[model samples]
Target: MTRKLLHTALVLSLFLPGCRLENLSADQLDLITNSVSSTFKAARPISDEEEYYVGRAVAAKILTSYRLVNNRKLTDYVNLVGQAVAIHSEKPFTFGGYHFAILDSGEINAFACPGGIIFITRGMLDAVSNEDELAAVLAHEVGHINHRDGIGAISQARWTEALTTIGSQAAKTYGSKDVAKLVGLFEGSIDDVFKTLVVNGYGRSQEHAADLASLNYLAATGYDPHALKTFLDRLVARSGGSQGGIMKTHPATRDRVDNVAANMPEQKSDAAHFSERSRRFASILGK
Candidate 1:
């Protein structure tokens, strides 16, 4: 009986990779796949050097289509806020001292590349009426950077020699059509430049982890933990049955807000940290 079971298990392992049985239960297969995938990343601090290179090699293509805001003061302001939050992150990352930029757009969006490069859109910045919401948003992006989600996303997408140049960075050219095509596919909506920056939204669990991390970052910086939930709530409201493909990549805003709220640390009056309706972060895009 034991010998027969061993043979069966080996055969199943061999058959599973390309298994295509339309009548098979989707639920059972998903559970099995997720469980198997978990083992490869069962622990924290996903470390793969190749993932970093692939992401770094693709960074320029992602940013090329974005319209940038050249406001020096506003740019500095966002960096200052982002830097403060990044230091407190579990990854505590400082990729070449991480560069941050503000992109000019009205659609809410932000993305972090390998090597600590992060971009925030004018739309998201305009939507945030105060410091707390901005901080919450930035922290969540940092969580992805620190966790190497960029690397994880790329691992699934093979980096062909056609994309990479003779060597690495120095030889690479991002203007290639193939790279942009890949980006279009990943982002899922080629409607606008912002649409091309589709970040691989983590699973529901990863988003929750980002929320918890953002809450901590906010709390450490003397901001209210509830601010995270507040910002996410605003996201849900603004999306209003249409997130324009951006929200489609991220987890449910409502469920995420609830999770962040549950994990918040109790505190006294949040008046000092609360900055709602303050109209702090502004944009040239706003009419």
Candidate 2:
């Protein structure tokens, strides 16, 4: 079987928990192929280097639409919180390592491109009440990067087409045709991730998985596991009827808050941490 088909089979088997892989029938295989084909044409395992380049492209696309925030203190603080949480993530280090930046937009949005390039809008920064809450959000984005959610959005067909064009070329460096094909694939890949992270949002399952991973990062970094829930609660209350920014880009706030509560760790008072962190946050963003 091709790599994309193999991946599809494995993913199908996962959802069937406890079912033997060998038990998969031809009909099931056909079903999987049809379902996947609608969304992807061909796929190959992306290397760390490829992911880094893709991430750079994605970041560049985002920069065209939004300016970077200019506050050095806020930027440094965000990186401090992001790095701390990232160090405790499932994938602690990445090909290019984690880098955090603030977008000047007040859109209450954050994005995690592949290869650990994370961005948070100034609106999101102002929305989070404390350091732990910021850590919670950043950790969730880190989970997306660790899981390679962005790369997974690319249609398998794009990779196959790009590879075919490259293989046809005889030059050591990409010729014009090869470069054009590669650039098209790269642009498609970026659009896939951009549409998910900004336009449509990830599926509920992906969002929940990231939330769980965020909790794990929080626990490992000595932040309150409830920090995410706290932030979500604020989001829910403030959302009132209109959904904007993060609400547009993430799962339902109520469902997420409930899930976090159900899976919350044993109560450990981080009142002191919250107190101290909020002071710093307020100093920067406001009361």
Best by TM-score: 2
Pairs with steric clashes in candidate 1? 105-123
Residues 153-176 of candidate 2: C-alpha lDDT, one tens digit per residue: 785546666545534532332234
List where candidate 2 sits over 4 angstroms from the true fold: 1-42, 156-187
Which numbered prediction scores highest in lDDT against the true structure?
A: 2
| True-vs-predicted CA distance for residue 236, candidate 1, Å | 1.5
* lDDT of model number 1: 0.61
lDDT by residue for model 1 over 86-185, one digit each (tens)? 8887766554556678877776778777657788888878777677778888888887777666555543432332123212322222234433444444
Off by over 4 Å in 1: 1-55, 156-200, 273-287
The whole-model lDDT of each prediction reads 0.61, 0.79
Clashes of 2: 3
Cα-lDDT of candidate 2: 0.79
lDDT of 1 at 226: 75
